[model samples]
Target: MKYYVGIDIGGMTIKGIVLDPEGKALCEDVAVTGSERGGDAMCDVIAELVNNMLSKCGVKKKDIAIGVGCPGVIDSKNGVLVFSGNLNLRDYPLAARLHERLDVPVSITNDANAAALGEAKFGAGKNYKNRILVTLGTGVGGGIIIDGKLFEGYKSAGAEIGHMVIERHGDVCTCGRRGCFEAYCSATALVRRTRRQMEDNPRSAMWTKYTSETANGKTAFDFYHDDIDAKEVVDWYIKYLACGLANLANIFRPEIIMLGGGVSEQGDNLTVPVQTYVDKELFGGTSYAPVKIVKASLGSKAGAYGAAALVMKD
Candidate 1:
């Protein structure tokens, strides 16, 4: 049977998956990227994991092609990673190198785009012609899939929604830009806001969840179910997030807006509140450009699944 391999590279973990031609999971493996150990070492770890997974599945190297879901500016056509601030990857021919080592065809894509394709082909966006998959993590990551295919525009850095400028003079982003959505709406943003709040009002109940001495180290989202301040921060955060979502919904008018990342796991608390805000602020009367808000069904594995799909077509 024909199979494809998918790899999702993150700051901490590197997950690899194998799927049949129909995209069914045959095997999955994970490795630590060893960020401190550097990129070349991390690639060796990935290769080991891939070889091990194929062996466990009783699949040959020639039976599968590889697709990598990496974090960075990927030139998908040329198989080069132009830049990756988090991973310290730059101008590397990742696909060609991996293909040479593994003795199989290999392709790579941005994690966000891979997740978008995963959703389009097998997850939430499967039934839609146009959809957006937004992931709120340390920073916001986005995947824009139009029609049934992943949109890789102008050298593959096309749909970077988090970097979209919402405010010209807002919060400064990691990319040195001011007012990018990721700077304002990411988990890092929530953490920053929590710290400022703690400094201003250190005796609040919110600080109780962080255990006085440790309050300075944790993020607002670290608040447990009983943490009131955490809820407040999230409420405010969701409101800010809605501003972006509303703007996108009004402009793109997609069938549905799919959210991923740790924040989306909050269930109705996040999605319901954000959707309510959108209902109130959006120009459409809720019927004309009605947008449904849903969480990504594939969760953390979406990127790997999507990358795997790239080779299954072989």
Candidate 2:
């Protein structure tokens, strides 16, 4: 059976996984990214990681192809990482360099896109022909899968869904935009809202368990059932999240939209409400085309698994 090596490069640690054509993981490992050491050093670390995985799995170099999911802008067509602020890499030919080291075919794409593909092939989106993975973390990151393939529009820079303006002139986003989806629907946004609510409502049940500084994405959810103030925060979060999801649903009309990241851990508490709002806001209504909002099953492994999927031939 042919094997594929998938590498997910992050600022802290680089995760790697070996997978078969059937999406079974043969081996999984991680190494420090050492990105501060420069792009070449990061490549060395990834090469070592691939070698270690191959050794452990008894897979020959010639029998495996390598796929990489990296943060920042990537020129996937040329296997070049155009820019990665997190990795301090720019105009780096990552795929070419790794291919030279291991003498195998290598492919690369933006990390978020890879995660979407991973879900499509092996995780939450596996059964759907069209799906999107929306990760509500520090920032809202997402990937689009259309017709069972990744849709990296216009040289792989187009899938930056977080920057989509869901609320024009509302809140400031890290991308310097006002009212972007990330500015409202991310976990960071949720924490900010939770803290603000606690500060405004001194008697909020959230304050019983967390101070303003300790308020997190789960803070409001924790007390929503019993606290009016906490429930307000949750309602606000779900409203904005549904707005963004509805915009995406109206555009792509995917079979499902999978929610990932820390906030998604709330499971039904998150999906149930957001689904209601999205269904209400759907352009042509839900009867013709329904979009199911589900939690991602792979958790942290989606990126690495998606990277491996890059090399798989259907």
Candidate 3:
């Protein structure tokens, strides 16, 4: 049976997985990114990890292909990492370097895009032909899948769903853009909004429950039912979130839009309301084409799983 190896490269850690063509993980492990050591050093570390996984599984190097899910502007067509501030990489030919060391074919993609592929193939969107994944973590990250294939835009740099502007001249995003969906929809955005509300309304129950340091994306949802201040914060967040989602739905009209990351842990609290608003504002009525909102099932492993999928057969 053919096997594949997947590497998920992050700022803090690099995760690796060995999987069968069937999408089941044979073995998986993780290691520190050691990003400060430069891209070459990082590739060496990943090669070592990949070798370890093969050794542990008694798999031969010649029998597997490698796929990488990296955080940055990945030129997947040429297997080069254009830029990744988190990894301090610039114009690095990651795939060629790994191929030199491992002697195997390698595929590369943006981490968010990999995660979206992972969910579409093996997680929440498995049943749908077209899907979009929106990860609301420290920042918003996502990808688009059409007919079960990842839709990376020109030069494999597109599918940056988070940067879509939902609010005109609204909050400033780390990307230096104003009113990006990420600026208002990310966990950082939620925490910032929650903290401001807590400070403004000293009598808010959230203050008793959490401090600025303690509050997180869940702060508003956690106290919304009982606290008017918290409720407003949550409502405000949902409004922007729905607007972004509605825009996506109107444009792509995918079968489902999956939500992942820290905030999605709210489950029904998040999906149920977001669905209501999205449906109400969707470009066309829900009768002709409907979209479903769901939570990603693969969690952190989605990137690795999706990376492995890079070489899998359809």
Candidate 4:
């Protein structure tokens, strides 16, 4: 029997999991990213986290390899992290260093790409050969899978779904662009839009439940049934989300588009509406080959599960 280790590195926490050959998690644990300590310190912390997970499961290091899902531009072929604003890393040879210290073959990928692979192999996308994962969190990020393989573009810098310009010259994006998909469809965008709507409709019931400070991605969603403003906000979000998704669907025509991250917790409320729009606008109509819009089953662990898959034998 063989085992593998997967680690998902975020700004605040580093999540690690040990998995058997069949993908069952034998043990899992987390550690503070300690990102303030710089890239070297962060890698050390990740190595320690892996060791802790291995110790907890009583697994021998010889039976395992490490797979890391990191946020940022990664040179997967060279096993180097080109840049990660949140992790404060640049041009770091993450895989090589980890292997040097832990003596385990290490693989690395962009977090979104890893999550997509995880879902495609073991989660909602397991049944499909081609799939795309659209995560609506603080920002929009996604990964593409084609013929059961992850597509990381040239130099592993592609698949940046969020930065796509859906509403050209519409709204300013954090990437310093106008009308990027992420600027209008992310959870952060949802909250910002909801807050503006709430302010515009001072007498609406939404004001009773949330203020600008209390408004979040779920605020309008929770009040959608009774508040016109709330419903409008959700509608606006769905419109942009569907536009971005439609672009991907037309280009890749994936069998399924899996939604993940915080906003996806809305489940059918989010998927149903977005699917309706996607169905309407997808190229060549839905009759020939319709894309199934579904929710990501792995949730927060998708990245970890995907990381582990990097070193697993299909």
Candidate 5:
């Protein structure tokens, strides 16, 4: 029997998993990322994680391949992490270093793209040939899968969907762009909007439970049924979110768009309205190509699961 190793490199923790070709996980473990020590240090920690998983599963290194999901601009073709601000890496030969340590084939891609592939292969998108994952966290990140393969355009840098402008000359994004999808659609954006609404309406029910500094993505949703201000904030958030999803639907038009990350925890409360808006605004209507909006099932393990899928053979 053959096995595969998947590593998800995060700022605080590096998660690793061992899986069979059928996508059944055999073992899982995590290690400190120690990214502040640099890329080489990170590689060592990953190698140790791989070894730990292999040992737990009683699988030989020769019987397995390795794949990594990392946060950064990756040259997937070259197996190099081109840049990662959070990881503090630049032009790092990630796959090569891992290959040297483990003596096996290794592959890598942007973490968001990896999560998309994971969902496509085994999570919400498993039944669809084409799908897109929109993760609403600190920022809006996404991955595209076309015909069951990742579409990492132009040296694996093109799928930075968060940077796509949804509102012209609107709020400024961390990427230095105004009106980007991330500026309006992320959990952070939701929290910001919620806080702004609470500040603007001091008598709002939202302030009964949260202060401007304590407001979060769920604050408005919590008060939506009772408070006018909260309802307006949620409605405003959904409008921008729908705009972004509609833009993606018009361009890629995938069979389904999976929502991931913190805000997605709202589940049907979020998907139902967003679905209605997207269907209404989708190009040429939804009869010919209706897009389904659903929440990603994998949650935090998506990146690692998708990384394992990366090394699985057909």
Candidate 6:
């Protein structure tokens, strides 16, 4: 059977997948990116992962098309990573560099864009023509898909809904911007908010779970079904995130919006409240829009699968 390979490149982890031409995953492998070493080290690690996956799958190199899903602003047309904050890379010719080390053709895309492609083609977006994707992790990252294809925009950072300003002088974000959606809705944002509330009262169940002794520690997500403080934080988080969703709904009217990452781990607690906010902010007659909100079906693998899809496109 013909095969394809997809690699999800992140700050600290690299996930590799071997897929049948039909898109079924036949083999999966992973390795640490050890990103502190930066560009040259990342290249070697990726090459080794590809070779390892190929060997284990018993697939010849020439038979497969490969895709690499990478983080940051990417110039997909030229196969360059304009910037990757986590990896501290700028204007790196990743595809060209990898091609020189491997014989097969390699295609590349931004990580968020890949998730949009993966979801639009195979996940909750399968039935939608236009969709918005948000991943609520350390920071909120987003993508826009129109008619089942990722939209990278002319500047390469298009559909970066997380950076959309929600407050003119609100919380500071990692990007040093005030009031970006990411400063309010990301997993880390949730934690920080919850921690601040918890500080006022350490006896709450959420704080008790981790305490000055436990291993796992209290998290922003605990409020979902548990502690009152955590619940308060979650309520506000849903509100902040909903503002972004509402903006998308009123502006683009996508068929659906899919949420991923750790904040999504709250499941219905996260989605149900966000829906409530959307109900309030949506333009009059929004019920007719049919823009449903959903959790991502692909999880972390979406990145790798999306990368693989780059090579799979006819």
Model 2 lDDT per residue over 1-314, tens place: 38988999988999999997677999999999999999888889999999999999899998999889999999999999999889988999998899888899999999999899898889998889999999999899989999988999888889788999988889999999899999998999999999988999998878788999988999999998999999999999999999999999999999999999999999999999999999999998989999999999999999999999999997
Q: What is the TM-score of each candidate against the true structure?
A: 0.89, 0.99, 0.98, 0.97, 0.99, 0.90
Candidate 2: RMSD over Cα atoms? 0.9
Give the Cα lDDT of each candidate.
Answer: 0.80, 0.93, 0.92, 0.92, 0.92, 0.81
Q: Model 4, range 193-242, lDDT digits (tens) per residue?
A: 99999888898789887788999999998998998989999999999899
* Two-way TM-score contest, 4 vs 6, winner: 4
Residues forming the 10-long window of minimal summed lDDT in candidate 1? 211-220
Deviating ranges (above 4 Å) for candidate 2: none
Shift of residue 183 alpha carbon in model 2, Å: 0.2
lDDT of 6 by residue, 1-314 (tens): 27888889988799999988788888999899987887777888889999998999888998888888899888888889899888899999999988888877888888988877777666877788999889988788868887766778886768788888999899998888899999988877766776677677777776656553231213646544767766676668778889989998888888899998876766776788788788788887565776788998899888888788777763
The TM-score of candidate 4 is 0.97
Each model's total of backbone clashes: 0, 0, 0, 0, 0, 1
Model 1 agreement with the true structure over 1-314: per-residue lDDT tens digits: 38889999887899999997777899998898885676677778888989999999988988888889888899999888898887887898888778767888888899889888787778988788788888888889878766666777887868778888777899899889999989878867776777676667666667655643364323565563556666677777887889888877877777788998877776676788889988888785697768878888999999899888766662
User: Which runs of model 3 end up more than 4 angstroms from their true locations?
Assistant: none
Q: Candidate 6: global Cα-lDDT?
A: 0.81
Q: Which scores higher on lDDT, 5 or 6?
A: 5
Question: Native-vs-model 3 lDDT?
Answer: 0.92
* Superposition TM-score, candidate 6 onto the true structure: 0.90
When sorted by lDDT, best at the front, the candidate numbers are 2, 3, 5, 4, 6, 1
Q: Give the TM-score of candidate 5.
A: 0.99
Question: Alpha carbon lDDT of residue 217, candidate 4?
Answer: 93
Per-residue lDDT tens digits of candidate 5, residues 1-314? 38888899998999999998678999999999999998888899999899888888899989999989999899999999999998989999999999988899999999999899888888999999989999999999989998888999987889888999988989999999899999999999999889888888899999889888889999999998999999999999999999999999899999999999999999999999999999999999989999999999999999999999988874
Q: Local error of candidate 1 at 119, Å?
A: 3.0
Cα displacement (Å) at residue 8, model 3: 0.3
